[model samples]
Target: MRKLFSYVLSLCLLVGLFAFNGGTAEAATGLTIKDLAGRTVTFDRTPKRVVVLSPGDLHTLQALGVQVVGRPTSATPVDASLQSVPQVGNIHQPNFEKIVSLQPDVVIAGTSFLGHIQKAQSLGLKVVITSGSSVNDIKSSITLLGKLFNKAQKAKVLVGKIDSKVKKYSKTKTKVRAVILFGSGASSLVALPTSFSGDVLAKAGGENIAASFSQLKDYPGYANLSTERIIASNPDVIFIITHANHAETKKAMIKLMSTSSWRNLKAVKNKNVIFLPSELFAASPGVKITNALDHMNKELLKVRAKMKK
Candidate 1:
């Protein structure tokens, strides 16, 4: 009777061990996600060594606490904290030789770098392509990164903050017509669609002049418009996003507008021109978007006050 009882006890222990191991394996399974460029990627496991090809990817990876073994030269100064990381050239054109030397397990890239995707795969490197130029794209990238790094909880928290800020700022009752001038002058004006800057402007309780134009399925960049077009639009407020060193360039553009025949347009006549930090508007999500939103909020308040008077 004692021998039979011992045999039963050993059998139960073996079953429990198998169940535990199976559960662990399931938990460690790598995830499969779609990139912005419409590529399906699968990670065998959490990536320990990563190479980031874009500033946005770098920023997102850092937020997720992933170790970036390689980055682009433009990413130099490496977030101060990551200054020790090696440079692998710029995302527009990456040095595959240097990237291979780094032996990165995974490479994170943007839609612009889709051309190199096949080469990366041929070298036996895993790659993820991120899509969209809007805030929604940012959110998706964050969640995808979270899944890749097994940091889904952290991604949720960060996204929640962004969503909350957008919701709160969007509640302003007053609405004003606004234009986002990328080049600082009336002649070089390009309208940002609701898909890109529209949601940010809307969050600030301002209307984008581009909204008045025909609805475009995709966001347009560096749109060229004639002086006559500017006059016809007649926007109430103008927001300029230019390079930091190009403040004078913006001023020059503004001066040129003043000399134009339509200098009397409402925005110019009232000096409603507002210049924003160039880097903040650069295409990446996260705190940068928050910074842009804050600047927009302040500018909108100024426009609101002026309109009330």
Candidate 2:
């Protein structure tokens, strides 16, 4: 009887040990993210100090409630909560010394700055690069950051919001023919279906007239369509996206559209020419992509309503 009792006690302890080990192993599972660039990075533990180098990425982290130690500089103000956060630098020109001083556990950079990735890695900083040039890219960035920061549920909610917005607008077809131009005057480049802004416009019910045109060799998402081609398309709505001098660009655009050939276009005759904000349309709006889509959809709906009259 004594021998049996001892054996039973030993068996119970072994089972308890196994249970504890299992729990630990389960808890030790780390997060691994594959960014838009097809590069993978793993996080064994939640990052406490992160530095985001792009406004789009910064916006995503803000939505996920992941605070950053450093943020990028933008012409417009960032989140009010992050106003006091140190500005390391922007995507084009990052201040590496300042970034290193921040001692971030990870640095989230954009794919536009490939050199930054190598420099950061050389400095022994864990880095992951992402892209937001497309709507899907925006969603992927949110999802990637969510997993990295242990905010997967929040990420899911944000992505669901975008999906819901897309679904809401998809049911109603506006039948609006539109053109999205990077600039208005001689430097204009038309956005293609492959571009992010083009995808947003398409999702919002506007048929991108430039979709069929050949994309630029260097930039597959945009094309340098001639004035004749644009006129032939005869888009019902013309949206201009300019990087600087909004007033000047608008003036030049108006002048260009007022020309004999341009004036004959349907959009010009109907006064449907519009200018989109660069901050919102030129770059990936991240969590605000839904807002961008809503704006476009509402505009298209207005156009449709007027057509009925």
TM-score of each model, in listed order:
0.81, 0.87
What TM value does model 2 have?
Answer: 0.87
lDDT by residue (1-309, candidate 1, tens digit) is: 999999999989777765764433423455677776777887665677888877767777777677788976762244677777888875568899989998887888877777787888898888887753677788788888887777888889877877887788868845778777665454354656644565677776788766655443433544555566667778888777664348586777668657856478788788887776655564564435666677778888888899889
Q: Report how far off residue 114 is in candidate 2 (Å).
A: 2.3
What is the Cα-based TM-score of model 1? 0.81
Best by the lDDT measure: 2
lDDT of 2 by residue, 1-309 (tens): 999999999999877865764333323566577877888888776688999888778878888888899998776876678889999887779899999999998898887777667777889888888787788888888888877777889999999999999898788778999998887587789999999889998889889988788989877699995788888888888888887677898888888888898899888888888888787798787899988998888888877777677
Once superposed on the true structure, which residue ranges of model 2 sit more than 4 Å away at CA? 1-30
Which ranges in model 1 have alpha carbons more than 4 Å from their true place? 1-28, 75-78, 183-189, 214-222, 243-248
Range of the 10 consecutive residues with the lowest summed lDDT in candidate 1: 21-30
